[model samples]
Target: MEENHRLQVIEEGPYADPGRYRRLVGRLVYLTVTCPDLTYVIHILAQFLKKPQVKHWEAALRVVHYLKGCPGQGILLTANTDLTLSSYCDADYQTCPRTRRSLSGYVILLGGSPIAWKIKKQKTVSLSSAEAEYRAMRYTTGELKWEHELLSYFGVRHDTAIPLFCDNQAALHIAANPFFHERTKHIDADCHFVRDALKAGLIATFKIHTSNQVADIFTKSLGGPPFSYLLRKLGIRDLHALT
Candidate 1:
């Protein structure tokens, strides 16, 4: 997807064949398992499956062209023996052109290799970027907790807090502070577990610079340079690329 291009639902337009578009998007969906770079664009394309337009078909084909450039591109988990777990979470505030819903995304890494990732739209409109980021932190905390327990079940001991990095300072403050202020009252009460996880030593919140926020690739469309940079940060590679 183009970084500046935003897809909108057009009620009356030259529509593409829904069947073909749906099948193409489905194959793209499966590609996401090995192509983190495709996650955001495919999510956008999947939205108009029922009423795809020619523009949408073009966008889908753009992804196919991208794949043609490097068919062997895929994530490469390192063989490092460290059992450390860390996560990066981020949110693109109100990016959906039609619904004004925020998109939240996170990537969980085990021993510096990504093992789980997700991108989702917030259920309710966030009145502030901090709230949207806080919600993303909460969702990531839940996943961290589950991952922690799963590792423990297999006798992996993680004595230290799992570091959860976010680019928003306000969200980091909210996650570290236990008290609820009037400004934070609008956020869902359930999201407070991010703070709980902090106190329970299950996770620790850290402030990261936006440029270093690798999870940005999952939440929004990025240009080629930054996209390739973050993809390299994830340890993804093309094993068959010419040397």
Candidate 2:
């Protein structure tokens, strides 16, 4: 999907074949297991499966065209022994025009190799960008906690606080600060789940510049150069590409 493009519910416009669109999106869902880059786009297209518009189908086909260009492009799991877990979490505030909901995403890496990721629409509308980002952090923290426990099962223990990177300073403050503020009064208590995790030393929130935020690729559409740059940062590669 292009950065400028936004998919929405088109009620009056010409619609596409629903069956075809659903099938394509269904297959794309499977591709996401190995193609983390396609996760966001597929998540967006899947929302319109029941009543897809022409624009939606076109976007789906565009994804197919992109896959054809580099069918072998995929994540590169390194052989390095470093088992540290790090994560990047982000949100696109009010990205859904119809519902005014935000898009949240996170990528979890194990020793520079992506082990898990997720892109989801917030269940409730967030009044502020900080709230949206904080919600995303909470989600990422839950997954991070689960992954942390799972590693212990495999006899891999991390004694230090795992880093959770975010571009929003306000959200980080919310997690680190124990007191509530006027602006954050409306945010649900559960949204501060990351704060508890922080107190327990399960994770540490770090400020990352938006430009270096690799999770941006999972939250919103981006232009070509930055997209490729982040893809490389994600440890994705095309080993079979012709020289």
Candidate 3:
């Protein structure tokens, strides 16, 4: 884990026991609910449940060891911060070797602190990166709406549209504009929910450059500096560790 670790199913190793692997990874899936740093690796391991190999098992064990290194690190929600809702969404276009499907990830922040995050493979293959990114935007909007409703029950009404940050300008434009054209014809009708969310004045899509896109960490493997950068941004602090 000290290195920029990425996971792939290693077939040359002996087959691993499915029961143990599933149990271990199942727990990690729940851990990912609050531990966004482990999202990408744990999600990769979950795919091989039926026919896990030695390398896959080893990778999962490595994750267990990594957990020991920072059991106390987690998101800290303070009451003093603002209640504004913002989100960052990103995708790894066609990075899944087996299905050739892209990965979509989004992070929801409450008052500049991360409250929720998730990453998973797209259900269908996307023909373009823009399409993949657009799909992620739609999902982000959905999460925003759900959170908005929950906050409304508490009498916290946001007078402004929630900001959904995305790195693809084409995807941003597609969500903001009502025009229909040949380039976006292949995208499914359901994916166009982003447009509806925009039209309703419930969401605002904005372009952010990749370097500052914190959601980028959730979708792909990152080096030490980049990973550390995101960890800091997510407010993940090792409270007792030495600086």
Candidates in descending lDDT order: 2, 1, 3
Off by over 4 Å in 1: 9-12
Local error of candidate 3 at 33, Å? Answer: 2.2
- Native-to-model Cα distance after best TM-score fit, residue 43 in candidate 1, in Å: 0.8
Residue-by-residue lDDT tens digits, candidate 3, 1-243: 434333453566656478999899899999887788898888888888888887778888988988898878888787798899999999989987777899999999989888878897899999989989988887888899899999999998888989889999988777766778876887757446777787788888788889889998888877879888988887788766887
Give one digit per residue, the lDDT tens place, for model 2 in 98-204: 99999999999999989999999999999999999998998899999999999999999999999999999999888878888787786757446777788889998
Error of 3 at 89 (Å): 0.6
Residue-wise C-alpha lDDT for candidate 1, range 135-236, written one tens digit per residue: 898889889999999999999989999999999999987776777887699884745677778778999888999888999999988888888889888878
Cand. 1 Cα-lDDT: 0.86
Cα TM-score of candidate 1? 0.95
Backbone clashes, candidate 1: 0
Winner on TM-score between 2 and 3 is 2
Which is the winner by lDDT between candidate 2 and candidate 3?
Answer: 2
Better of 1 and 2 by lDDT: 2
